[model samples]
Target: MLFRSLKPLLAGEQHLQLIWLALGSVPVVEFAAHANPDALVLDLQHGLWERTTLEAAIGAVGMHVPVIARCAENSHGAISQALDAGAASVLVPLVETAEDARRAISAGRYPPTGKRSAGGVRPLRAGLEAMRAADRDVAIGLMIETVEGVENVEAIAATAGVDYLFIGTGDLALSRGTSDSEVIGRDCERIVRAAAANGLPCGIFTANARAVRQAFESGCRMAVSANDIDLVKEGFLAARKATFEC
Candidate 1:
């Protein structure tokens, strides 16, 4: 197994991940990509990212990091494109059933098992052995955000090729008509148990001190912190406020 596999082995595993907007000068993205973190993910669901900007950002960060992409959806084209872009793994959003999780895995794997088209200059040119290792180790993370997703967490976790069952707490709360934190924590317990049982890793998003502790205690080895925009905005506001007060 790869070094990235360490995230899933320990109970209450905690990883500090930074989520990037997938565009712009991408200073923050580059910083986090090179940071001494276990893993990081590029968010492409929002319109904030475009292919050109994504290319530039990825180039700036280089390919030394354990980088993964959260595709717009579970579409094969999107997943395949992300892999070509040099993502070591793909996080498929809104996975609600076993089939949904299965499709995401298929999109990540090569032919003979999946329909993913052969491409990507990076992987193709990186040597056949490297590519094969990547294919074997490429993580397929599924976002369980819907009520159906929560309900089928066990089944989805048990699916082959499914590596991480990432609980999208924000959406999970909204779907279940509960507070974000409350719903996330409640559902996290179930998802974590399911993941532990299936010998898979569980992922979660951490915001504050409380959430960080909760996620770790809940068995989420891989955790994503706040996004780039939010962090920048918060940093700017803090600096501006301090200057004005002085």
Candidate 2:
């Protein structure tokens, strides 16, 4: 629970952070949290994960750090289930318009505001007050990956209840037909400015440490660095290199 208390403050301002899970498994996610990366993202969107395993993973990260899950879609039921199961926050992906952003937020929040159902168990049962506190401080990051999303960046950023507008650079670059371009720097800057203009935090995903730092300087407040398979692959590759050299 070293970084458990820091989540509340993340909601208060545009702060810098590193999200260490994109293709991570439960054990991998837990390990990263223990190592004290700023945060972790349980990617239900683009991974082979069962709901039960996902719940277990969330439990593992519970109270240790802010665990934000990326949902399969902006499915209200899935959002509600994740929240009730104790996810500190949700990141909805491929949001292409303000309406998409609105729906995603609606799925996460409760009534008078939105329609997240009331159900509690496991991690949620142990710390109701604190969980509510975390929800109040929850970071609902929306992924702006598509060309349509980039075009609608302003509108999406303007949507109420969107805490962070994450620039999914890989997908965005692919959509723009310039995945290899140095123009990414300029493109990201544009999106960052859009997020800033709407008073929302800006986030990005990059494996390259240099690019992560560059994103921070370029106004990206949050970033996803590495995931399970890739992290392990890199480590093994480095180890093999070191062993051969030695």
Which candidate wins on lDDT? 2
* Per-candidate alpha-carbon RMSD to the true structure: 3.0, 2.9
- lDDT (CA) per prediction: 0.73, 0.74
Report residue 54 deviation for candidate 1 (angstroms). 2.4
Clashing pairs in 1: 13-221
Displacement of the residue 84 alpha carbon in candidate 2, Å? 2.6
User: How would you encode candidate 1's per-residue C-alpha lDDT over 11-75 as one tens digit per residue?
Assistant: 34445454545444467777776555566577888637677666555556545566667889999
Off by over 4 Å in 2: 1-7, 12-15, 22-24, 123-134, 243-246
Instruction: Report the CA-based lDDT of candidate 1 relative to the real structure.
Output: 0.73
Q: Candidate 2, 7: how far from true, in Å?
A: 5.0
